[model samples]
Target: MIKLPTVSLAAIGYEKFLWKNITELLKTGMLIIGIYYCRKIYKKLDDLQKKIDKGEQDKYDFQKKFEYSLDKIKATIDKGEQDKYKIKQEKDNIAQEKDNIALEKELNKEIEQLKKEIERKKAQFKSAWREIPLYADWRKEEFQTVKLTLDAATAHPALFLSEEGRIVTWQEPCQELPSSPERFVSIPCVLGQLYVSSGRYFWEVEVQDAHSWDLGVCRNNVARTGRVTMSPQNGFRVIRLYDGEYWGLTSPETSLTLKEKPCRVGVFLDYEAGDVSFYNMTDESHIYTFSKQAFYGGLRPLFRLWSSDSGPLVIVQVEENTTML
Candidate 1:
């Protein structure tokens, strides 16, 4: 066998040292690369943490703003409820005031009506007292004479006429008079033959024993065939006597309280001046007057006797000199 060469110890040592240095250098390069990659990963992690913190802060600010807006809305809703309550209270007060004013007006109207009725009664009483015996004789000098006669054609069937148709008496049994359209059928009444249109006339009627009677002047076209109330609307202006009470025949009948009963009644008429006056002939005092009358046509004397009254209603004959007294 042939031996090649024998290695030296120094050469072997140098080769081992070279191998160790190469190993150390490779380890250092690997450590440097690891450090650079670790630093890059740390920077990325830090940036992600900052973004998370900012998101949390933004969420907190949004919650605070939402709470503030909700509080403002609650306050506005409370104020709106308060305003609605005030509006309802004001409307109720206005309605109550109108009702009170209407009630006051109705009360005033009733009071005024009562005053007028009182005044009318006062005037009636004053005229009635003037017909007393003390003042009766004093009014006799103002009398004027007028001749009057009853119209037989206008007399009721229950009435009997005498003294040239100047006297009328209510008979229980009806007379055998002809039924005429112008005659009074139910009431015991009569009309005068003479009618005065536009002149002053005066006449006297004697009702000494009569209980109830009506004496007046009526228009020529007054109702004569039926039962009629002696009123101004019916063309009859009169003084009525029934049940010991007297009344003036107006649209609404007015009561006339007399102090004394007159045996004879005097009637005076001024047609042009529209005046009809009555007087108590026995006492010669003024009784009542019909004023402000509208005389459209001829006016005739009208007389009515109650059904129960049996006494005669006579037209008294007045001498020209006695009427002037």
Candidate 2:
């Protein structure tokens, strides 16, 4: 408590006291205001920090979802491509199977055709080679060369006569032929215009094309209707090539083997000798002989075609001066 220059120490004591109290009050109020402001600012800062954290979390979630969606889309694309490849592969397999089936069917057809051809060749080889005496020209001269032609009057409905009635072909669907007693039925056949009851006659027939025919002599009074027996005992002295096999019309059909296939066949018929000899004129070789057989009535040159597949038989005419036939 020191005395001031203008006032006494005791007089200034109360003023100092008052000034000190007021100063203390201002300091306390300022400290409280500072604390309040600091607290509010800290609270606002904390709230702002929370919001930023939430936003970051949302961004992270969004990024993760985007990545997941990308991966899912990629997987879906891969699966789609795999399915497309599988479908294409299946289609290719089906096309290949169809091709295989078609190839197999074609191969089977070829195999069947080859087998048939092999069988046909085998039959030809079996009947190919035989050693026999060649007919002498003098013996051939003993027979008269008969110029014969097929008779249309005695032709079957299925037979077609052409080439000056020298060709007799087996026609399909038959022709509109007039019915007669001389016309053959149930069999495709034709008789010659001239009939021989006597004398030894020799004639050559051009039997071209596939062999399914009969050539020889038949009795004029043979059966015209129904199944006519072609045996020699049944009025038919014939030799036929049937189903690639040759047969002489005997009581029990004799099989004939030849060294060569003859396109032109020569038939020598002796009525009194009862000998009907067939010759392969193409090779000048004897085929088969119908020996020592009884003959009666007029015998005509018979041409029989077994089926529609049988080729035409052409009566050959030669200019050789032998006996008049």
Q: Best-fitting candidate, measured by lDDT?
A: 2
lDDT of 2 by residue, 203-301 (tens): 889986757999998999999999778988778989989888999988888999878898899888888888887888887777887767778899999
Error of 1 at 280 (Å): 0.9
lDDT scores for all predictions? 0.77, 0.83
* Candidate 1 lDDT by residue in tens digits, 1-325: 4332224534556544453565676678778888778777877777777777787778888888888888888878877777666666665555666666777777778778888888888777766766455453444455456668899999888888895888988777787988788888766778998788876677889999787899989998877665777788888889988888888998788887655688999887778778787888766777778867668899999998887554778998876533442
**TM-scores for all predictions:** 0.56, 0.57
Query: What TM-score quantifies how close candidate 1 is to the native fold?
Result: 0.56
Give the residue spans of candidate 2 off by over 4 A.
1-136
Model 2's TM-score against the true structure: 0.57
Q: How accurate is candidate 1 locally (lDDT)?
A: 0.77
